[model samples]
Target: MRGLLKLTLTQMKLYLREPVATFFTIFFAPLMLLLFGAIYGNEPSPLFGGRGSMDVSVPSYIGLIIVTVGLIGLPIGTASAREHGVLRRFRATPLHPLAYIVSDIINYLLMTVLGVLLLFLTGKLVFNVRFEGHLLSVLGGFLLGTLAFFALGYLVAGLAPTARTAQTVGMVLAYPMMFLSGATIPWEILPKGIKAFAQYIPLTYVVRLMRGLWFGDAWSQYGTEVAALVGCLLVGGIVAAWTFRWE
Candidate 1:
């Protein structure tokens, strides 16, 4: 426990010391949210039998970015750390190495809250957008989504050999994931085949579940989304654990 704590603290310290990385990580998603919200948020909810639309899309959009940029981007950073021998040195230390990764997860969680709040507050203060869903419900979906994406990130970190490769691969993977998962484009606007295909992607389920929470959609509304999140976390975790290497 002490070892884990030290490692986690070290990880947090690294993030704290590097203000640029933290700034962009914490700021980029919400910036994207704000931009999108400014553009599309003014329009009506165009799909899913939604009511005369207002700014309801704000929270869901924030939640979606939180899962993507924050959670999915983590592995790319870890892969860079691996290439730089950060992970290798940690393995040699008395510190619990997994705890280091857990620390990254924790920091991302904190950032998620900040990002979501920023988006929500920005929309409310600037655009009069309000939410119907409980914060806890959306937060619950957000955490679940984070876990799933973190698992995917670990897999990328474990598999990608070089920092360059990690960056390239991460971009390649993240772009499609974001698009298909309904973050870049809403699933409601997508075709049937695309939505069907999205059903298999872990991030898709996460975004849907999150939207459900934000919209005050019934608990039974997104069962498949929740299931996919759990499944991805489990499978991706196993793959990452099996594939991870010090170098």
Candidate 2:
């Protein structure tokens, strides 16, 4: 446990030292909130079911964090480490390989949580964003969505032959989701054709699950979303495990 903790801390420090990672994962959502909040002013909008724009945006932005960390951060970091023989070196250590994987997971999860908190703080402090859901329910959805994405990230890391390939693939998959999944823009405002396309995107489920929970919808109301995410988690985990390599 001590070794795992140290590894997690070290991984976190390394992550923070990467300016692009820190900026996008930690600060980007909050900056988006400020920008949109300034433009929309959190006014109760008929388009957003009469909720303030910031109210809906804050929860949706949680998906943004997940996408950035899970798709962009994890795949690139893991692949780069493998490319540089970092994972190979860890194999020589006494600690199990699972220790390295777990530590990286912990590092990414912690960063995701911090990013979410910063988003909430920005919304609440600047726009007084309202949250109507049960905290536990929102938390459950958050964890489920995060794990689903993390699994996909690991799958990407395991499959890509090189760090450059992983970066290219991750961005290819992640950027479209950011726009289409309603993580960057509200689903209600999307074009009809875009909304139809977005339904096929996995991150759309995360956004729907999060936004519904944040609006105080019961868990039972989100059966489709939950099932989709669970499917993603199971399939991604199994495939990533099979394909994963130390170097």
Candidate 3:
């Protein structure tokens, strides 16, 4: 346990040192919120069913943060480490292999939580974003969505032959999902064709589930979204476990 904690802290420090990862995971969403909040001004809108723009935006941006870390950060970091023989070197260490993997997971998860907290703090302090849902429910939904995407990220790292390939694929998959999943733009304001297309994107489920929970809806109301995210988690995790390589 002590070894795992040390590894996790080390991994976190490395991640923090990466400029792209730090900016996207920790600062990007909050910056977007500030930019849009300034433009939209968080007025209660009929489009969002009387919720302020910031109220709806804050939760949706959580999905954006998840994708940024899970799709871009995790895959690129894991694959780069593999390409650089970092994982192979870890195998020679006294600690168990599982410790390395667990530490990576812990590092990413803690970073994600920190990013979310910063986002919420920014919203609350600047825009006064309202939170109607119970904190536990929102937390549950957040974890589910995060894990589902993290599994997909691992799958990408496992399948890509090189760090460059993983980065390419992750960016390709992430950019479209960001725009179409209602993570960057509000779903209600999107065109009908775009909305129809977004239903097929996995990130859309995360956005929908998060927004619904944030609006104080019961879990029962998001049965489909929950099921879809669960399916993603299971399928991605199984495939990633099979395909993952240490070197």
Q: What is the lDDT of residue 49 in candidate 1?
A: 59
Off by over 4 Å in 1: 1-10, 16-24, 41-56, 70-72
TM-score of each: 0.83, 0.98, 0.98
Candidate 2 to truth, TM: 0.98
RMSD of model 2 against the true structure:
0.8
lDDT of 3 by residue, 58-112 (tens): 9999999999999999999999999999899888879887788788888999899
- Model 2 agreement with the true structure over 3-69: per-residue lDDT tens digits: 9999999999998999999999999999999998889899988999888989999999999999999
- Clash count in backbone of candidate 2: 0
Residue pair clashes in candidate 2 = none
Q: What tens-digit string does per-residue lDDT give for candidate 1 at 126-216? A: 6676577887787777888877777877777778777777677767777787778776576667799888777777666776787678778
TM-score of 1: 0.83
